[model samples]
Target chain A: MAYSIPTRQSTADIIFAQLRKEIMSLDLLPGTKLSEAEVAAKFGVSRQPVREALNLLSSESLVEIQPQKATRVGRFSMRRIEAARFARRAIEIEVLKNASENWSDVYAPSFARCLDAQRRAVAEQDTHSFQTLDEEFHALMADVAKAPFAFQQIKSHKSYIDRICALSLKDAAEMAVLVRDHEALLTHLAAQDATGAEAALRIHLSRIEKTIAAVHHANAEYFND
Target chain B: MAYSIPTRQSTADIIFAQLRKEIMSLDLLPGTKLSEAEVAAKFGVSRQPVREALNLLSSESLVEIQPQKATRVGRFSMRRIEAARFARRAIEIEVLKNASENWSDVYAPSFARCLDAQRRAVAEQDTHSFQTLDEEFHALMADVAKAPFAFQQIKSHKSYIDRICALSLKDAAEMAVLVRDHEALLTHLAAQDATGAEAALRIHLSRIEKTIAAVHHANAEYFND
Candidate 1:
């Protein structure tokens, strides 16, 4: 989905969303200080809302708050990253298995639509759009399986993975590989082959392992050991 | 784990924790109005922190905030409860499978200790302690599997299940069944039987479906359809 600016959120909600996006997209890099006073001034709000926003972010582990010290964008936590990967893999595999069992002709069109959008994104070299479509593809799987909540967990755990993917997307070949993985997964699902679909998904998700290593080597300073 | 009152928390943090406990324990019953002025006065803090705390709770779906309307303890959301259940079941089953594979002699003592504590809680008729121990049992499984993050997801999705469980715990027989389920699960784990452990865990988690029904029947007002 395209990131539409929220129009009707509370001041604190707006600040939280903006800061969360910046942090997840790595615009506010790890270890970057977030001054409450400066953020308040920049958002044209008081420190109360700014502090509230920071507290919200801290809860998500996107920002670290130290008592009597400055708040900073959280360093990439390898443990949390691994946890996210594990949770995503487990949930998506389960979802794919369910989708494979319940596969119908109606689901094929949705998969094709997402793949078509993804192919366009690849040709345009729009990594941002590709990333959004990538999420949509997985979300469609969960939707087909009637397990929308699985997508919520995946989305929650995906921030870390997405940030790493953001860095890895500079390699155009990576996007092509992702599109191919989606095709393979769709083929398996179309055949109602749960085992094959799961295998395809395992390979699809494993791409992140290599991406994590590549991203970490290039941006070691952003990570926590 | 013992619910240690946080000693080194900010004003907002303290309020959030206090309100969260009250809400989760059903001390602050669903639909109870939470006025900012009243809460601030009750806590002897300013409204700023109170608003922040409410915002925090809102994020967790423990409180509901509507623009230009008073905030209140959220009505128990069945959809959210089901979502939590689905996520918890998927993650825990995966954790159990992993724990079964990595089962070692060293892991038996931890499960036994938790079971021992659970037995004590049941005998003493301390449902609260039983609840805590129940969480410890599952967390220990995740810990043994070397997937601590899985426990985090479980914990995060558990608050809804937990609140429902707290309501259901008035039935003494229910607690006995839970302890028995733990014993059964532990037996499978000790035997390193992954499939058997998964089956045990599934049955263990399925207890909540009945509890949800019973709790809703007894306390219909607390729930939303």
Candidate 2:
């Protein structure tokens, strides 16, 4: 008979998402040991689901599972991080090109809303809220392009990047720079200048890449060390 | 204390890779339950490492984990498979464009080598071998553009498409059509015509998409039914 979608996801999926969000938000630190029994007890589920959830996280590279040893929250690898950032930049360039060619008025309000949320987050100086808003803004751009799946890939890649960015979350001034870039991109989108919009997006994406790298270098001890 | 820069990852990562290869190759059928203790016993490791490997598979969406229930080989989704095909086509068009602009003689041999491999695979009637070579051919194109990461995304998408393709492996004549398309793409890539190359790549991707969709419709029972 007909029923709700069943969340068809196992308890492991639920546990995995909860832990992943914690890891992504830095509620769980990198190098933190994720004991299966402990997690199982905490969630009041069997160690099996916790084990399954941890397995999923390991595949995402968000956790490290060592043989005969403990599984830990994943540490940052500068090289892998750089590679992901580069891929994101490359793919977004092509996406921006598509957006430029097919600019739409439908996405403007979404952009405005994300921008407004960003403004509110920054004005409040709440790092957590600002970062969340930042993700929404980038997602809005992808949605504006009418390719939500592409944005999903972008979000996954961004999630990898996000774990690291969270390490340097105290940079409020830099948030302003990102806000400016987003505004410029929104402007280009509004003007329907495909060429202009692409140029702005490239610059905007580059700023993010550069800032991320710089922060990583500045605090080398916080990463793969 | 140096040990070849740890070229070998942890056992969990290694097992995850091996299992992923098997699943992608369809040696592991959809809906097959993977027992942690059994797999661990087979790998001569503890359940801890095996659990981690399964987690990795789950993250890739290659395995399905049920909390306190069972972790099975991932089932195919027609919608996810379609999305992956579309994404691959979208990105490859841009990658082909990049290759055309920066066409080089250095990668010609590499390209031809993959093409020859595909030819050999076709002659031998080995669909599995042919698929690997097909992936290599697309990879070579991305290398020509000096953007190897582009192929990484393509492969990720290809995995989703391949799960569906596994069931539709009966049509030798249709396979022949796909081979011809690959040959045409190679011809255009060799000529360094950005416009022509992209057009060919788009045609190649679209054909596969159409074929795959047709197969999916005809065999809906094999999918997420």
Candidate 3:
């Protein structure tokens, strides 16, 4: 069920999407000050739409709105990142379990195609493409499980950890390990082994524990709490 | 791990919160046209804040914004609601399992107190308070499981079903059944029975299936899909 209605984006909507992508991809680092006037000038829109965009970001906790002061990209919090991982693990585990039980031969080709794309991404050392495919991998599991909204919720939680995950994905070795994990998960699903797939997913998601620690150790200033 | 930072609410934030509550409570029924000019006049603010509020609501799918046409409260979609329930169940079942395993005598009083409040709400015929306490019941389970973010995610999904749930809660008999389900769930948690508690939760959340069908039958015009 596609819940998205095809409505045209307002100026504010476009600005919000662009800023959200930048923030999530770490093109805009945490604690970076955002001036409404500057953003308006850059986007060639009035300050009203910029302010609206900032309000939207503030609601998502992507930015902090300090009245009478400046708005800054929200800093990372270890607590939030861990909490998000915990929540994502719960839903994705369920998704994997269902996908394993409901596995069919039809999905094997796409699963294998995605794996090949991941290998290519790692070989090319294209971190951005790897990250996008990584998301698509998990989303594919949700599709196999026929639980589209599970992936939507996972995406919502993913934002909290994207900065750290992006930093982790920069390492080619880490990308290789993730691809192997995805391969293992797909193998389990293809075999209709629910327990094996669930276990494989747990190991896959736990890679973040080390990544979070390494990312935070290297960039402590970007985080709060 | 309180992720919420206490920033002062802007005019738009206040209006957003108020309108969100109205929409979720079904006070501002589905398909009700919302006018920026009138809402601005009513709130004694410029249209910018009202538009911002509406935009925020639109982001949550609580409102549908048609650029040239009128913006109206979003009609309920059975597909989205079911998807929301599926996502909510996945996280919540895990929460209940953890709460059962981590059950301690210390939290029993609070759990019992919440159940008592639910009974009182039903007896007093206070559907609104009952709903609020029902949320608190789940939040308490999250605390017991030490998974606060899980409850936050559940609440996010809950908003997708709140309008229908609110309608269902209007019946005293239905409210009584829900209270009893809560009681059974609490009993299993108190006993530290993970399997039992998980089963109880599955039964508890499944009540929405019947409620959705009945609510949609009676209020067919309020739904889009």
- Using lDDT, give the best candidate's number: 3
Q: Which stretches of candidate 1 lie over 4 Å from their true place?
A: A1-7, B1-7, B120-126
Question: What residue runs in model 3 are displaced by over 4 Å at the alpha carbon?
Answer: A1-8, B1-8
Model 3 over residues B156-196: C-alpha lDDT tens digits?
98878877767764688989999999989888888889778
For model 1, state the Cα shift of residue B53 in Å.
1.1
Instruction: Give the per-residue lDDT of model 2 (tens digit) for A2-28.
Output: 786756676777898899889988899
TM-score (chain B only), all candidates: 0.90, 0.81, 0.90
lDDT of 1 by residue, B98-179 (tens): 8988889987788888899999898998987887898899899999888987888889888778777677646567889989
Give every candidate's TM-score on chain A.
0.92, 0.83, 0.90
lDDT of 1 by residue, A1-225 (tens): 968665367788789989998988778888999989999999899998889889989988889987788999988878888888888888887788788888899988888999999999889899888888998999999988888888988898887678766665555677899899999999999899988998898899887787788888999998887
Residue pairs with backbone overlap in model 3? none
**What docking tier does model 3 reach?**
medium
Candidate 2: residue A123 Cα off by (Å)? 4.4
Residue B30 CA error for candidate 1 (Å)? 0.7
- Return the interface RMSD of the candidates, in order shown, one decimal each: 1.4, 3.4, 1.6
Q: Once model 2 is optimally superposed onto the true structure by TM-score, how far is the C-alpha of residue A214 displaced, in angstroms?
A: 2.3
Cα deviation in Å at residue A61, candidate 3?
A: 1.6
